[model samples]
Target: MEISSGVAAPETRKCPECGSAVPVDERYADWCSACDWNVDPGAADPEPGRIAAARRRLAQEYGDQLAAEMERAADGGGPPARDTATVLASGISLLVHGMTALLVVTGVLLVVLGWETGVQPVIGVLLLGTASVLRPRPVRLPKDAPVLYRADAPRLFELIDEVGAAIGTTGVDAVVVAPDANAAVTGYGLRGRRMLLLGLGLWEILPPQQRVALLGHELGHFAHGDIRRARLTHGALHSLSVWLHVLAPMPAVRLLDRFVNAATFVPRWAVYGLLLLLDRLTLRASQRAEYLADASAARAGSTEAAVGLMDRLLILGSVEAELRRESVAAQMLGGRGGREARDRAEEGLWERLALHAGAVPEHEYERLRRVAARRGHSVDSTHPPTHLRRRVAASGGSHPAQVVYEGPRAAAIAAELAPARTSLARRVIRDLAG
Candidate 1:
């Protein structure tokens, strides 16, 4: 098998369990393909807390059911009907917001009626302050956050606008670059102006077309109308989560505190139950939105590119490991323990990552797919299983790219992102060193 430059060819080794020849790449774990030995090495990682474990289990269950349902719908040529769960979820969300509104009105009334009484006015102000604290607020970028404005990256913005137009939504107001290995779309400010968050770790490794596919998938969340992304539902969910956190029972350290903790137990559980119910109600709709987004990705970037994006996603763990390995190797070779090592690590970081991603062979992809299936892995608790999404992308049939991004325009976008690339790489290396 051909290996890209900077990556060594895999050495063959006998699988201890099955006696089968396994291609062992130093970049990845050695696993027996014939008998499926050591396929899921991640299983040995530390167990998650109870809530996270439960959420993962629930996500896996919902993903399986939704994948089957979506497949059937595709085959039958009929979309599933809107169900009561969504309506019920929306209603509950509205009620939560209504409660917040009630608090605001009550606070105002107290202030208006008892303006003359010092104690009453003080209580009224406190109530108003509490209401303000609980109010739903739009997301805001940090002042020092790295942002790419249209003027600075016109070509990139134009490409984004083209994709947005194809997906039936206005383009983003700005692009925020971060060090994460993920991309997302979110709204900011009171007007809810959209923004695209591009993670450099993921972006630096993707081909131009696959990057377009990633954009399509994220922007699709807006075009496809994900209820969870809607301000009303999202705000309510946030408020409820906050309520749950606030109502949690505290450890009793004294006699009076014991009584207080005891009194709060029922209310704490009540809030917990409500949050769980709301999550369950919205689960199916949120998952359906993901599938729809994948369809949009296929349409915008072509099915082939979308499928390739999924393949990239499947091996993100390996990508991350490789990045850390590079950082460590650079640090050791540099011989200096401080800024010099970090600078050495940051240099050629993106180039090395791109090559490492490119060097992943077809067999490795297949192995990751099998491991994903075995582990019931998804991008997160919110996303559907990656394998299922990949299948959907492939089954959507061939599609011509709706908005092409290549040549000089692509180079221009890269040029615009150069500063961000350097900063993000330095940040990653510094973090690893620390």
Candidate 2:
């Protein structure tokens, strides 16, 4: 295997193919005792920083708290779904919290850069504000953007309205389901229209209550004003990335393109790497928002249901994901939407290779994933970490709760939760009417 130029290993060598560590017998100096992975004794060992960064991300996701939550979610079946209003609050909390956290950080950047700190944050809030004002505007299912709901999300919109009424989720305009098992609500229209998308899988597997809870979580984003914040921040970043990429997709920007791809060298995982390090800071900021949403659910009198909703969502997103990898692959490459086969093939290879040996250390990768899986993938920033949510649920506390719920769950637990489950029937007619 070719060694990555930027990274070097420490002390022992590991097999790129199987990840078995090569033992030092000196007798078989060039070979791995377990996997026969070739080695170069002269290789420059990488500094410990890379491994350290990866370890932090893993620890944040899998920490004992996250693990316990996963277990609790399994035992609970799913949250109760009697009230829809509270659920909307929960979802909105996530969006608002995420935006507020980002703006807080951006404010720091502007201040430190000696720019108009007030102006920066004001601009940030305003940008997102535009999206927020139109937050409840639903996405009109377009022929171009086909509704591809995940197995989950059968009553997505109804729940959206049910929970939203309490949270002031207004003007439910349009809805669409993507093949991907993620949900997002957007404000569309020139002045900003309200829209939402629930991953079909989210609707499929999560118990109805959990489904409402999921909606609450998303709509909560709008309620907390996160939808607006996300809009501005994401828009700025997307434009900046695209413009900057024109200058430097790799590193240094040419003189003319300098303003364009300013963040070009900003690697994807690297940003997450930074966030991973600051996970606690992010969590601390978001936890409050979550509390508010949880309370929102409680106020709507669906506390137990909210918790159950969260549990079921955790269970489904994890298991269903593995079974539907092919669909994800299709959506990623735009399916038959007109991407070139050769280009798509190349992209696939790169994505597949990202998880391979020595791209980052195999032991390191496994170590992190092992920890992350304990809590499920959502701890990263999608939902409340299972532990925290379960704690509130069990405690009988209800408020807006927004914790990171971004990844897959434990397979065994998911399988157990998945059995005997029936998907909420899709109100395809409801979507078609629009």
Candidate 3:
């Protein structure tokens, strides 16, 4: 009983909570739209732990406040004022980098003194090694990773450049295609050259306009001054994390080892406290960066496309589930393992995924939206709640598409991505089969 649009036909039913006539669909949950009963069935379950619950509460509170502030700023035709949290986070990052520099200088001095003054060479060498390991290292691409240079993907790069220009950023240097259900942009090497990682699982399902919105959102991280992504702060955070790991106490039965562990306890706790403080200071600013990025998405791809992108994100869980089911089906149908099963899995994968995405009914989308509002769900803890993001995106009236991707240009980009798509899809299917 499905309509031509591929949505299940609705049947009338009485709501148990409010006795209202609800339009019930066989393919989706039936909830009373009038009274909002059973809007979020999973709300009865407790959060994983107290800490997670507290974080959700905080995210909800901050999201509400930020949305209102952004709306007011939009009305006033001015940028939102910078908050103290970003400034404090930057200060802490500088202090951490300073501490790292001090360690490097101390290591050098120790080595020099040991050589010139006839002290223990071994002690100096160990300190020097530790300092070297703790030093901030530039980002590097993984060895033999599948990469698309501008020559290989000119149209795609051009499209990305247009989106970046719309949002006031220089486009990426390269593109990396992978199997994950997400997309991201990051810097690599000492000069911090930008790169885009496009996941086929997510990309294949997006409409052309929404794809532009996706690019705008990722590149927007750079334009929006996201502190977490900045080299100094990002490197400092990494150094502190590594220091904590190295200083952590180990299990020991020997008395000497136990004593050694006890000796390191104070320093370990100090580093732990510093890490916590730095993370807390930066959390709010990082969340705000995401909201601003959404605004960039709107600017590039129009309000409708940006909201469509968010809706796609809301259904990502279902998309991943479908991929898993397809993997199992391919393996079962193929019978024999190895190349045959892998081939079966990759064949027509994207088409099947797009079909599944299309079958998702409007009622299901409404249900997910209600669930997000009720649970304050987000893409991750660092992001504000998805519902809040949607509100902020829509609060600014509709925008015309600043960069369009359609017709021949869209086909050319798809053709360019064909090779990487096959490689990534094969890898994903192989991993899932195992």
* Candidate 2 C-alpha lDDT tens digits along 118-164: 57656655545544442333324556443423233333344456677
lDDT of each candidate versus the true structure: 0.81, 0.44, 0.82
Residue range 142-196, candidate 1, lDDT tens digits: 5655798899889889988898888887789989998777899999999988889
Please provide the root mean square deviation of candidate 1 (C-alpha atoms, Å): 3.5
Preferred candidate (TM-score higher): 1 or 2 = 1
Give the per-residue lDDT of model 3 (tens digit) for 304-360.
999989888988888888888877777676666767776977977887888888788
Candidate 1 TM-score to native = 0.90
Displacement of residue 391 (Cα, Å) in model 1 is 1.7
Ranking by TM-score: 1, 3, 2
In angstroms, give how far residue 417 of model 1 lies from its true place.
0.8
TM-score of each: 0.90, 0.41, 0.89
List where candidate 2 sits over 4 angstroms from the true fold.
1-143, 147-159, 227-230, 243-291, 294-301, 325-376, 379-384, 396-434
Worst 10-residue stretch by lDDT in candidate 3?
A: 43-52
